[model samples]
Target chain A: MIDLYPTRGGDEPRFIDRQDPVVYGTAEDGPIDAGTLAGFDRDGFLTIERLIEPEEVERYRAEMRRLGRDMRGDERVVTEKGSDEVRSIFEVHRVSEVFAELVRDPRVAGRARQILGSEVYVHQSRVNYKPGFRGRDFYWHSDFETWHAEDGMPRMRAVSISIALTENHATNGGLMIMPGSHRTFVSCPGETPPDHYKHSLKDQEIGVPDEDSLTALAGKHGIELFTGPAGSATMFDCNCMHGSNGNITPFPRSNVFIVFNSVENACAEPFAAPSRRPEFIASRDFTPVL
Target chain B: MIDLYPTRGGDEPRFIDRQDPVVYGTAEDGPIDAGTLAGFDRDGFLTIERLIEPEEVERYRAEMRRLGRDMRGDERVVTEKGSDEVRSIFEVHRVSEVFAELVRDPRVAGRARQILGSEVYVHQSRVNYKPGFRGRDFYWHSDFETWHAEDGMPRMRAVSISIALTENHATNGGLMIMPGSHRTFVSCPGETPPDHYKHSLKDQEIGVPDEDSLTALAGKHGIELFTGPAGSATMFDCNCMHGSNGNITPFPRSNVFIVFNSVENACAEPFAAPSRRPEFIASRDFTPVL
Candidate 1:
């Protein structure tokens, strides 16, 4: 079998052309029509102004607060390094019913199924709680690189949806994805140590794309900062080069992040890592949404 | 590899002793404890008094009403034979967010995971709406028989959870399962037609255990009728000889039914049928619940 989009192997990180098609589904398969499907295929990402209503968004925001407050002791709750601030709550949907309902929402899961051209499962879900001043910056990286090397994802057949719980302003650690950057798969240089997710979830160091590769990508495809009101959402390809700055502003930036992987593309064994990460970080469940 | 639980090809119906373990998980795997797990293994099914709270039950009751009213035109809504009254709403979770949340609830999904020893997906889901006076009886048969013959489910590695939206009384067509009958695999005699589900969902005539086989099983293992208050639930093995009677009483019996199949035990090509059923009745999607 041919292994497309190989990563986390070489001494120097290299960029390879993506082998898989960007959009997998047709107009008749799901909610996405031909035009929108074509746009997503070209851009590698699509943003919506209001994927959820105000009342619904408020519910998720409330759940995020409760998860941050009540689940601090849970191992799935990753805290910011050197502080008590909750950095992220992995598998948020499992812990909170409000967030669980959001995952089942047709507006969310339906779109993922439409884009993936098949039934999809939640590969990972987290509430990225970036407090006003304490939130640290997430460096530039391709999610597929980490997923492939550490979690044993066989291909770039996953897509991530980030639903903003708070207003994502340009200055307050909003996501910044390079346009057309998803076409290239950047093989990161690293060895994924066993149980690396324990430290990496708090602060990722390994499996990061090298500076030269990042610079070249940034130069080729200009960075696009996602700024929108609460309830706004963005769906991006798994291999897209993306990251966000630290929130120095008073407005806290928080988003409900969910990754959807095709049922056909279930993880096998870790391609480069010594072992697989915990299910809360990189899920092994392959049940499709009903 | 040995086909442990084989079915749907013999001229005469016969029972084979179960080769798979009844309870696949230990206490560490999920919510079901040692004693409870053992109890489920002894009997083919287990009943919970308050699987969900009264309020949660009401929400499902409301959703059932909404689905019956609104989704009557949808192809997934199966009607009672010789009547316009809605019989069952197949793929109810996909059509309603409220029912969708119920499927994701750990109380529901966790128990399935606990019993199956692995991540599970919704093999099939429906809101069985047996209306008063007009409802018809479901013939005695094991779900795995039809699933194997028509849907290509290879083993009894699946379980069905029925949560009462309305109070389930003994006279109101409550589910009746033969205790210890799950240990026997009745090889159903018949060829499932190409579009068997179109008729079977409304009224199944094929892939049913013959009267002689059913009589022998009923004589050996005694029938137990499930009667419980609203919010009460039952989890039963896929191969259990079970069926419900017609509701002649004024009280209507409605329950949210969901089937959880182990991701590893996904369906393949049909074992006996001309073709596989549609996704609504026999789901091809094997994405596990988060």
Candidate 2:
């Protein structure tokens, strides 16, 4: 098959136009309204305040804390490179019922199905925990590049929903996405080493776009920080250029992140990597969410 | 379109021999061993001691307590008849991450897929809470009957797994199943009333087998109580005649119960009811567990 969004091979990054549509379904066909759908299509992302209730947010925060503490030795629990603090707990929906319910919630999964125009399944799920002082940053990159190269995801028919479990303020590290950057797929260059995810989960160094490319994308599209109260959420396209800064604030930051993939675009063999990432990191289970 | 396992709208209870194979997959193709598979085929159920670790059991117990305390007034929380005590929480896998992880656990979902010989989805899941003294009895009946009549489950291609979160002693009202009773599908007579699950969940009065039929089945197969320590699990066929008495013991009995149905046997229109039961009670989501 042709590698439309190729990555992890070569010396310089390659930019390619996105071949997929941003919004696959119309408001007439799903729970989202036309105006909101249009806005999402234009910017490649959308933020909703209070997408979940306060009680639900508290429950997820509790679950996040529990998993962070209990899953210390588990491989799926990725820790910060420098500190032992947990950076993310992968496959959280499969492990946590609170996040699992959120993955199936209408505001999240319904919108995903609508955006992809098909039944959706979880490709990946995690509780990103940015602890108070020593929290680390996740470098800027397109999720689709890694999913395609390392996880064997066939296309950009996926959407990610990150729901805030704690209040996200300017000081606390929150997600920053380049509006309209999803229109272009930045194919980072480098051969993915064996077991790349083991290191990448903690500190990604491979397949990161060059500084020039990052600067160009940010300059052209502009960066937007997703800041909102607990229970707020942001849904972004798979190829959106996004990352977060390290949190040094007194207050912690946490979110339940879920990636919903279209069943029609199920994964295949990796396009660039030596092997596919683990199921907990990038699920091979393509059973569509109903 | 014929009603093979017909119930309700009939005058007398009808007993039909199970038409499907009990063990669908060979041990060589699945995680279960040949000896265990043979035993399950013969007795229609198998119990594995310490199916989960003690720590995991305690975690689930904690989750159970939390759900029971906080889920009041939620429709999915079924209170005991004539009391405000929470009897059961339906679609528990969808509501609580702890139970959801238990549902996806290899010993649970993997064994289910092997027994059904197909990718399986959660047909129903609930945390059965039988508190001391006020805990009500769940009358003897084949789960397949209610599923076939009200939920439109087509065949006996489903299995139920109950994992004890607390020590299950005789006094605490553990499950009791009629050995080899699954071979006979006792088609109970009576038209299924609309919204039957509302009453049936707390205290079942509908789709129950006649006493004579139950007596004959018990007389032939004999009854066995599943008494075990916390973390032990029992997997039983859907058509097995089973029930549990009220717990009068101070040590309350609770178990995480999940039903896995083959993806091939997804629900159709109600075979004998006015409308299908709600999604939480009888899930319409047919996404197979991977």
Candidate 3:
């Protein structure tokens, strides 16, 4: 492990890959423009205040609730509290039409292409159900690290879009991401921690940066919380360090995450050990999310 | 359902979407020309005689054989015989990196993009194994028809690359395609029949054209069997009418099939009832494969 916390610090940020076209488009509003693109390049993430409509969000939330009721299999549907409570539904797109449509929505896919300059495929799809009172904490970690070490992915060419299906505010433990941390490539060691696949009740640990190191990194880049009304969507680079706290508020935090990886940099299974997670969770089908 | 068989007997072909840039390149040969592009447009398919070298083909075949040894789950590993023989390994890309690389190869993806004029994602992947003694027949049908009705694929904007791993000739029951049938959009009916998933031992039927319909179609626009040495790769449009015969020869007919769909034309779950097939086999991840 490289202990990637930056020593030198400033509030001001440095941006790279400025020339690539970044789209500032939403589901309600069709086309994207140049200014939105620039902001994304500068921050390594973009926030669409209202990407999905409220009605659609309600419909999907109801669908998620229905799906959570019937979920079977090894470790797909997990929980912080035991006995049928929802935590996350792995690969929700396959089971629900609404989720599938969200993944293929041109509003999201168009921006992904603009940033990547290549065809894109969904690396993973999961619906995080952070129920009030018992919701658990997700320790700080970069997604690319786990993908590279465990799934045999060769590069950090993916982006994850977290769409809020419920109000996600600071009190409810919304996503907290380190600003501009995409520039700091962490050399994380170890395979996917065992608890990552199933429920995180016993252990909420997978490639978590040590506490002191995390404190230092947070001090340097600072942590930015993604809190918004339902339908708000945030697109973050795969390498951006992100985590969420345990939700104790009455408000539930539910979000659908769709991660897009560039086709040109598609991975081979690099790890010597086979993945414990099933195909649906860590997808092998690299078809571009149309 | 509209029975879309042609009316008259002729070898003449019709072309559509004439302006898109189609590639003439292959793995062995790097550059493509206008003449080759025109041929693909006219015939609705292309043939790359040696996409994989001999050594690579042998490695993949050995890997496939190894995979066949211990396949768990349902009809995914279909066979001509009972229990554990090789007929087709659905989603072979998921289990083996060699197969994944083969599907994502620039040699394949480049031509697909050239013809499609957009980003491409996989529709499906399978290793068709026509075993020596008990290989069965594949009835006449177009792939797009099934995809449109059963999988919610919106259009025929997809292509399949079939590469011969074994000697694909007449005796071994090679692929039989109706040239120019890409112009004939068939309205296929019925769900994926039982036994189409796990094995084909019981029923060899699904969306096959009736005898009169097949006779009229074949009579008007003759069927052509693909015959070539190992390593020969053929790319055909999704709507191209095709099927294969049963084999009794000692030499088996095995081929790797990769289907690519354009991202712009991706679809919702269009079918009335959901497909019974597994997600890995049919694929819901529309992420454009780079």
Candidate 4:
């Protein structure tokens, strides 16, 4: 059905029947079985235990290191406590070959197309670098809440594909998601904390969710931690209530993040009061990925 | 100036000023320097020594072997002299992660966008398997002739980026290109040679270039052979007249090929007498690369 209150372009709300087993297993090439699709629809996200091969993992890891350090004037790399270590690298695809390949990968983006059902574009590409002891906790919130309020995203016709560049686990503080919480939007006092790495967060961006609401949601639907082998991938809906804990463990958890938005449902003009976030944080170009 | 007769969409002719040093060095991300752009504009192509990293090369080679052997009824792989060995793999990006990654690699496809002056799409992709002695010579002809006369490409705004999985050399039938031949379109007696593997060559296609014309052109412009180390990449214009000789050396030359066409100047309706080549051969989807 068409979205009556779309904040962005001419895209209507695109929701898959959380009960559809048929959509998950069906792809033009590669093996994404029917059971997988069913699980993804029922939950807010689906995890492919091993989406990347060993060679690719090795290559990606090496490239990520160089991107976080060697790539000069690479403004996207957010640091931890003003130190040299990287917290996250937003839009690494723009600077490196390896991450660029990941964003448009058929195994990753093809599944996105299966769910979104149209040509999809990369609204954002990021690398969450949860280095050992350096990684901090991310506040609980739905991504769409911030995107709609700050970036002018119309609806939730977007999926975030995260591939593990390093082993993601509980100790390392991998992403923790609230299953099936994407059905409704939660309104809260969203603000950009001053501690944010430059242009990383914006005003009206719901970083810290209300404790009462988060507690109620957690009581109803338990959280699921994204923990897996290197190269494992997960596709989550944009509105999925999610966050990650602090990584104090020696094992660093770094993952490549690619946000695929349906071409018809691209972001609109600036809705935030001050100004829109930079193109790197929230892309303006809506060219669809094949 | 606009294309007087655009094929399908309302796309006009888009040209890159060969004299403009600014176009190459100013990508949002990645190193597409002025020297590279100048080379591409001057010689009708540019070859990057090591675009694919060693790990990616290893991964792609491994995947290509399995795909050539195990992937059954997947008809894209072109075979040797009726042997099990794969001569070429077409539309590989649709099937595997490694190849998919290669097709969209920013270092490669990003350069394509630089020349095409718009979002680029894969018009066709194939790996040319020039084995030690089994490989055949691809006769001299321009790709644009086949694409324009047969595939109905509206203009010469496409570039093919070929990455060498194995070291390509003069002895191993490395690509022979006529520099600056892209300036003119030659109408030749193009036919589908029977010796060509199934799904490799098509009817009403230009394969053999006129000898007199070829000799005259070669005499005037001279030829350049693309011989480089493994992981090397070359981006050549569609209208560049190119072909290769049979490999007599022991070193096998197998390279992954990706043809990127500007979305605006994509292929129109097939002009061939028979049925149009399938999507696997000539993809109709014009979704741009991210």
Q: Give candidate 4 regions above 4 Å deviation.
A: A1-31, A190-207, B1-290
Show where candidate 2 strays beyond 4 Å: A1-290
Q: State the fraction of real interface contacts model 4 keeps.
A: 0.00
lDDT of 1 by residue, B140-258 (tens): 77898888877888888999999988887544567878899999998877677778888987777788777778767766886677889999999999989887655433457889899
Model 3: lDDT of residue B247: 50
Residue-level lDDT tens digits of model 3 in A167-203: 8754456787778777665544344444354533334
> Of the pair 3 and 4, which is ahead by TM-score?
4
* Cα lDDT of model 4 by residue, B170-275, tens digit: 4456787878876655555534333332433521123445555666666666667688989998888887878764543335788888998889877776443234
Worst lDDT run of 10 residues, candidate 4 chain A, spans A13-22
Which residue ranges in model 3 land beyond 4 Å of their true spot? A1-31, A72-74, A81-84, A189-196, A199-206, A271-276, B1-290
Instruction: Considering chain A alone, report the TM-score of candidate 2 relative to the true chain A.
Output: 0.97
**Model 1 segments beyond 4 Å from truth?**
B1-290
- List the candidates' TM-scores in order: 0.50, 0.50, 0.44, 0.45
Tens digit of per-residue lDDT, candidate 3, span B1-290: 22122211222322222222233233334333566667776677778888889998898788777777757544567655553556677878777888888877888877777677678888788888777534655656677656665566665577888988898744445777767667665443344544354432223345444444455556567666677889988999887777765553345788888888888767556342245356666687788775
Worst 10 residues of 2 chain A by lDDT: A243-252
CAPRI band for model 2: incorrect
lDDT comparison, 2 vs 3, better candidate: 2
Candidate 2 per-residue lDDT over residues A104-198, each given as its tens digit: 88878899999999998999999888885456667788899898998888788999998888888654567878899999999888799999989
